[model samples]
Structures are given as structure tokens and as C-alpha cells.
Target chain A: MILTVTPNPALDLTYRVPRLLPGETHRAAAPAVRAGGKGLNVARVLAQTGSAAFILTTAGGAPGLRLADDLEASQLPSELVPVAAPTRSSVAVFDESSGETTVINETGGPLTPAEWTALHDAVDRLVVPATCVVGSGSLPPDAPDDVYARLAAAADAHGLPSVIDAVGAPLVRAAEAGASVVKPNRRELAETTGLDDPVAGARVLLDAGAGLVLVSLGAEGMLAVPPEGEPVHARLGTPLTGNATGAGDAAVAAVASLLAAGVSDPSALVRRATAWSAAAVLAPLAGELAPGFRDVESRIETG
Target chain B: MILTVTPNPALDLTYRVPRLLPGETHRAAAPAVRAGGKGLNVARVLAQTGSAAFILTTAGGAPGLRLADDLEASQLPSELVPVAAPTRSSVAVFDESSGETTVINETGGPLTPAEWTALHDAVDRLVVPATCVVGSGSLPPDAPDDVYARLAAAADAHGLPSVIDAVGAPLVRAAEAGASVVKPNRRELAETTGLDDPVAGARVLLDAGAGLVLVSLGAEGMLAVPPEGEPVHARLGTPLTGNATGAGDAAVAAVASLLAAGVSDPSALVRRATAWSAAAVLAPLAGELAPGFRDVESRIETG
Candidate 1:
């Protein structure tokens, strides 16, 4: 089974407004709430793809309980580590007119040292039989920036492959800790490698101990760079456009699924991963690979 | 003891941002949560003013529980009637640069007939030896528009003075039920009475069997029109500039306090009420009267 960790999870509240006036009152035409975090998104996508994935997250207070309740209502399997402070909430205001999304992210609750240890313990318990472990999203307050690195190292020690989807110092640390795979978007790749070109940045991550590197270029498609293999290009078979909020998570899930299924070819993994990411954009909510996504997946071009 | 009833209360969440850009993600610099509703605001102000007001509200689900917890944390007295769904949450996004507030209000949980009967029973229980009973805000779903009117009639039957702060058809029904006092802002008064002039609107409400009519004219102060006494005008002697979100509720609290204190003159009541409303703008949060707000009471100019 795949184990997904979302250290800083949230109850994401989305408001739909016709227009957002700076200082004027705008009523939300519709509102929606979802349990959100990068790892949660990955797990959700895995579930949609008919994979057995368990979500481990830290949730607290009423919002946290509500988040857990929502996951249960959605029939998503999850185990929550309770905390004292309320889980942070992220507000996503969607403008249907321009299809632009503005996100207001809350700095999530701080974790106690014991809570962090509890998380490590949970990871230790899951790693014994897990084929793969996925760590995602930002580090909450009181957590070291290298927390993901420690988790990746633990996965490595347990002989389990790890997928790291994060940015900045954490991404650097995860690479140094020998993450099996690292997925970074174009902008993140630029920041991580200080390279103007994403292909060059993917090469840097590959050189930095990541066994495999996947670079997402939004509508342009994806590039896969392996430590010893030639880089492969994957493109969506058709032009599809929609919300891209959780596309990266979908890519990570696809890579994990392919790895777990014993697909060792980087070209085949990149082809499948890019198709999944594109399918996620077509789905309204994050993590769900669109229906007939496989049909679309079969048509993706791997060059 | 003042009995405050909030037919539709909310858990108000305020997000402060430098500016709000439509279709773009904006992070909140600061976020705060508070228990909110017009009657809840009145109860909070009354509590701060050393009045032991008993809040009668339908508090249920997670948000309702949070609101009750907040009230308890504040040491405010309250009696809650449980409902089926969670209370609504209102989002107020304040842009500091433009000093503009955008409100996204959610329709609160609908009360079942059983819940409405339960609330009525609770009101009946309070009818014995009541001083002042206040019903405020919009009617919740599944509840009749005449809910406030019925509550007012119930309070009158028990020789309790009823103060109603609502708008449109609810205010008209509340006044027709012979509310002792009905407070309507200029815009609400115009909407209710079909009169553009607030003074004329006040007279219309008074003619509808309201014992006293209080029309709040933002910045200009308040107008008090009683059944037998001549109309009294109270202008702001001191220029006050602040958020007017809960100013009307603060004014209601002031009127209740003066009535409890046995202030018989409409002119004196209007002066104290307007001053308190002005003081509300100075306070950062709703339901909090500014320190030394009582001092402004004497500055009110009555003509």
C-alpha cells in the first residue's frame, strides 16, 4: 500500500464570485469546502486510479474534525493525528469570468516536538510493508525545513521508494536524502537549480541524488530526466485546459503507481504521468483522474 | 435581565489583506474569528456594559459549537437551542489600502418546525419576569418572516418590552405586532416603509403600531419618533470614523441599557443610543464599545 504524508493539511474553502472589487462587498455565488494538502491530493488521485493509498495527516480543532469528517464522507481512507490548535484554512476565490484563482493561504498550526515524533513513529509503522511513501506540501511552524529529508531517508532505510513534491530548501534536502523521485514545476525547477531552462534544472536535480526527476511545464507537457538514462518528453494527446490546482499531485501519483506496478522505464513513467496530470486539470476538484483518463493516457505521445 | 434572540447568527471570519485582486490569490495578513449576529452583538455589548444579558440562539453543528465556545470563553451568558445544521459563516475581507470591506454572507442553516417550536418554548420560558426581550437579524430558512413578530407579541403578552432590529418585511411585521421599539437604519427604513426620507419612514413604522421608532442615519446620528412625543433628533457632536458593521447593534444595546436604567425621555434615549453607535466604530471588533464610550454619551446633541 502507498502511504501519503501531509504535515500541513487544510480545510480549503472556495468562493465563486462574478467579480472581486478591492474594497467593495462581493457576495459568493457559490461556496465549496474540501480537505486539502499536497499529499492528500496525491492520495486522492491514487484512490481514483484504483490504488490502495492511506493518508496520514495532522488535523486539529473543529476545522480539523470537519476535515476528517469530509474525507470520511467522501469515502477516502485517512488517519488523523490530533493537535490542540485549529488546522489552518486556505481560501480559494475563483473568478469564473477570467478563470483565474486567487489563493489566500493561512500559516498552519505549530506542531509540538512530541507531535513531530508521533509523525515519525507513524511513518515508521507504515514503512515496514509500504512499497512507496509520498511526502508533500510546506513545513508547518515548529517543523524543521529538512523534515521531508528525514522522512525520505527513513523511506530509503526501509527499502521503500519515496516521492517528494515540495519546493525550496525542503526540495534540496529531499534530493540530498536520496528521494527516489522529485517532481518540480517549471518555476520551482528554476528556483531549485538557478537555471533559466527547465531541462537544465531537471538535470541538476538528477545530479543531486534524485534517482529520477520529472519537470512539469504546465500546458507544454512534462520532461523526465533519469540518473543514467536519456531524457524523455511526454505530451498530452489533445489540448485540454481547466483548473491546474492539483495537477502536480496527479503526476506524482501516476509516477508512484507506475513504480509500484514494476514499470522501471523512465519513458513509460513520463508518458503515463503527464497524461494523469492533464486529466486532473479536466476534473473539477483535485486528485481525481478524469473519467476515460486512461483512454486519453493511451493516446499521449512519448518522444 | 435582557433576553437577546438571534434568529440567524453566524461565525464571522475576517481576513485582512493588503488588497483584493479578482481572479488572483491573495494571502490574508491577519485572520480573526468572532461570534456574530445583530442580537449576538447586542448581547456582547450588554455584557461589556455590566448587563447580564441572556442570549437565546440556535447553536448547532461545528460552527455553532465554536460560537458557543467563544461566548463562553468571553464569559458571556447564553442559552442555546440546538439545530440540525451547522450555523453559517460570514466572510469579511478587509482591504487595508482602500479601507474597503467586502462581505460574503452565507444563508444560515434552516430550522425545522420542531426546532422553531423548541425556540418558541425557550422564549416562553423566558417570558416570566422579563425586563427587555430583543429579537434581531434576518429570519433563518424554514422559519416564517413573522417569527420576530410572534416573539414580540409573546414578550408583550408577558409585559416585557420588545426591541426589534430587522429590515424589510420582518421589521414591518415586528412593528405591526406592537414592538415597543424598532430600530431601522436609513436604507432599511426606506426599504421597509417605501419612503426615501428616514424621518418619514420612522413615522410610517410608528403609525404601524410601533411604540417607538429609531432610525439610524450613518454619520448624521439618529432620529427618535415616539407615539405621543414629538420627533427628537440627535446629531453626532464629535466626528466619528470607523467600521459600521455592528454600529446599529451597538445602538440597540444602548437603547436597551437606557430603558433598563429607566430613562423615560425619547430624547435622552436617542442621545445615548447614537453616542454608543458612534463609539462602536472606534472599537476594532463588532460588539465591543470603545473604552470611555460612556463619556461620548454626554456629547450627543439633541434637538
Candidate 2:
């Protein structure tokens, strides 16, 4: 089974209103809460695609308990490491007039040294007997800058592949530690490497020892680069306006599942990942591709 | 014991941000979650004051489960009736720059007919031993508009005092049903009675069979009208700026506790209630007064 690590999980809350003014009272429609955190989202999407995945996450206090309870009720397999700080919550206010979402993400509190160690230990144990391990999301404050690097090395020791999706130092470190795959969105890639071209940015990660690099190009679609092969790019037939909240997580899930299932063709992996990510945007919530993924997948032509 | 009925209880999520700009992303500090609803807030405040209060509320699905779990963790005594729809969540975004709180209250879903009956039958049973029965917050759609009226009558039949805190038609009906007390703020009172004067608006409720009418005059303090005595008004030495979220609930709790203990003097009730409400404003959260309440109470004058 694929193993996913979420150092900072959250209870994602979404509120819907007819219009959102700068300073005013909003009588919103009923709010919705979901299990969140990039890695957790990856695991959820993978499971929906008929892949078995387990989530390793940190949780604490009442909100943490609620997250655990939600996972338990959903029957999603997860290992919750306890922390002193409460888990954070993120809100997405959907404005119906403009059909836009305004997000407010709580900065996750730092974990104690002991808490960080526990997370590392948990990941160490989970990576064993696992087909693959993927680390997604930002590190809690005071956490080691190379947490994904450490995880990549640990998985490397076990002769397993680890997919790393992060920004800045963590992404660079994971690549340096020989990560199997590194995925970054266009802005993240540019901000991290100061490169406007996707191929040039992907080349940096590949040169840093990442076996492959996938860079999301928003409506322009996604680009895939294998260190020793020609780069490939794919997009949908037409751009669609949809909620792209967890599209990246959906892409990582697709990569992990395909890699675990022994899909080594770079072109096929790129096409499927692009279609799945697009399908995720079409769905209302994060972590699952809509049924239209089938049609989207067939129409995605890679060059 | 005091019994509090909350027809629309919620999971109260408070997010603290540096500043909030519409349609922009914000990275908030950690959020706080609590069991919230008008009656539940009243019950929580009363319990903090060393008074016994039991909350009767509807709960269903994940959000409801979280609210109940939070209440249990907080050691708040509550009985939750099962319902089909998930309970709602309310968000309060505190902008640190201006120290302003922007609130988004969700419009709770309608309870099934059976659920409404269950809540009423449960209240009828609890009101027997309850010294005071409080009907707080709005009625869910599909519920009888005269629910507070029926509840007041039920409490009256049990020889118990029924305190109603509501607006619009429910307030009018509760007063007509011979409620022991009805608490309304300046706007709510004016809106309901279409009267500009607080005394005149309170007189309307008193004339409709309410034993006492307490009208919160915002910064002007509070005004009380008793059917058997001259009206009384009390104000703090000077109005203090603080969170006024649960001030009304705090006032209701003070009224309930004093009324339950057989404190019948209108001036004493009005002074204590106004001080408690101001104390709530000084506190960080709803349902509990801060230490400044002692000084505020001593400064309160009823004339």
C-alpha cells in the first residue's frame, strides 16, 4: 500500500455565500468540513482510484480528535501522531456572484522536538513494507529543513521510491536526496528556482538527482521530465473554470499509484496524471476525480 | 436546575488573522472551536457562574459530533437529540489590525418533523424539574413559528419561569404566551415592535403578558421594565471596548440564574444582568466573564 505523510493536517471548512463584501456580516449557507492536509488528500484520492493507501498525520486537541473521528468514520486508514498544539483549520469562502473562493489558512503551530521525532519515527515504521512513500505539504516551524530529504534517504535505504511535493528548500533537499519524483506548480517552481520556463526548472530538480520532475502549468496543463529522456507536456481539449483546490494532491496520488503499479511509461503517466488533476478540479471537493475523468483522460494528447 | 433549549446549535470556529481583505488569501493564527448556539452559550455562561444548567440541542453528522465532543471535553452538561441534517458551523474572523470581528453565521438546515417533535417532547420532560426554561436563538425552518410560545406555556404549566431571548415573530409570540421574561437588544426590540424608544418597546412586551422586559441599549447600558413596578435603567461607569459576541447570552444567563434563585427585585436583576453583559464583552470568548466584571458590577448603578 502507498504511504502518505502529512505533518500538518487540517479540518478544511468551506462556507458559501451569495456575495462576499469586504466588511459586512454574511449569513452563509451551511458550512462543510473535510479531512485535509496535502498528504492526507493524496491518500484519499489514491484510495478513491482503487489504490490502497495509508495516511500518517499529526493531530492534537479537540480539532485533532475531530479529524481522527472523521477519518475513522470514513474508514480511511490513518496513523495519528499526537502533538501538544491543536490541529489547524482552513476556510474557503465561496462567493456565488463571482464564483470565486477566498481562502483563509491558519498557520500551523510548531511541533515540539519530541513531536517532530515521533513523526519521523512513525514515518520510518510506515515506510517499511510499503510499496511507496510520498511526503506533501509544508513542514511545521522548527522542523528540520530536510525532513523530506531524510524520508527520501530512508526510503532509498529500503530500495523504495519516495515522491516529494513541496516548495523551496524542502523540494531542493528532497531532490538532492534522490527523490523518485518532485512535483511543483508553475509559481512554486519559479519562486524556488527563479526560472520562467518549465523545462529549465524541471532540469534543475532532475540535475539535483530527482529521477523525474512534474510541473503543473495551470490551464496550460502539466509538463513531465525524466532525467534521461525527452520532456513531455499535455493539456485538456479546452480549459474549464472549476475549483482547483486539491488538484496537485490528486496529481501526486496519480503518480504514486501509477509508480506502485509498475507503470514506467513516462508518456502514459503524464497523460493520466494531467487528466486526473483536471477531473479533481471538476469535482466540488478535494481528493476525488469526477466520473468525467474517463473522457478527459482519453482526450489528453501528450507531445 | 436551569434547562436551555437551543434549536440551532453550532460548531463555533474562530479564526484570528492579521487583517482580512475581501477575496484575498489570509494566513490566520491557530483557530479555536467551541460549542455554540444562543441557549448553549447561556448554559455555558451560567455554568461558569457556579449555576447548574443543562443544554438540550439537536445534533447530527460530523459537525454535530464535533460540537458534542467539544462540549463533553469541556465538561458542559448537555443532551443532544439526533437529527438527520448535519449541524451548522459559524465563523468569526478576528482582524488583529483593527481589532474587529467579522462574523459569518450559517443558516442552519431545517429539522425533520419527527426531530422537532422529539425536541419539544424532550423539553417538556426537562422543564418539569427545571427552575427556569430558556428558549434561545432562531427556530429552524419547517418548525412551528410559535415554538417559543409553546415552550413558554409548557414552562408556565410546570410553574417554572420561562425566559425567552429571540427576535421578530418568536419574540412577539413568547411575550403573548406569558413568558416570565423576554430579553431583546435595541435593534431587535425596535425591529420587532417598530418603536424607536427602548422603554416603549419594552412596554409592548410587558403589556403582552411578559412579567419583565429587558432591553440592551448597547453602549447606553440596559433598560428593564417590570409589569408590577416602575422601569429601571443601569449603565457601566464607562463603556469598554471588547468582544461583544456572547454578551447577550451572558445577560440571559445572569437573568436565568438570579430568577431561578428567586431574586425578584427588578433593579437588582437589571443591575446584575447589565454588569454580566458588559463583563462578557471584556472577556476574550463568549459565555464567560472576565475579572473586570467585579469592578464593572460595582460601578453599575440602577436608577
Docking quality tier of model 1: acceptable
Clash list (residue pairs), candidate 2: none
Residues forming the 10-long window of minimal summed lDDT in candidate 2 chain B: B22-31
- TM-score each candidate: 0.89, 0.73
lDDT of 2 by residue, B1-303 (tens): 999999989888888887887777688776687889999889988888888999999998778888888989989888899998878878888888888887888888899888888999999888888999999987776667788998899998988888899988889999999998899999999999999898889889988889899998887888889987688999998868988888999999988988899886788878988999999998888888987665777899778
Question: Ten-residue segment with the worst summed lDDT in candidate 1 chain A?
Answer: A21-30
Off by over 4 Å in 1: A15-31, A94-101, A190-204, A228-240, A295-303, B26-31, B127-129, B226-233, B237-240, B295-303
Model 1, B1-303: lDDT tens digits are 988999788888899888876655565533687888889999989988888788888887888888888888877778889998788888888878877777877777689989999999999998675688899887776677788898899988987788899988889899999998999888889988899987778888888889899999988999998887588999887687778878999999988877766664788879888988988998988898999888988888999
DockQ of 1: 0.43
lDDT of 1 at B135: 91
DockQ each? 0.43, 0.45
- What TM-score does candidate 1 reach? 0.89
Model 1 residue A167 CA deviation (Å) reads: 1.7
lDDT of each: 0.85, 0.87
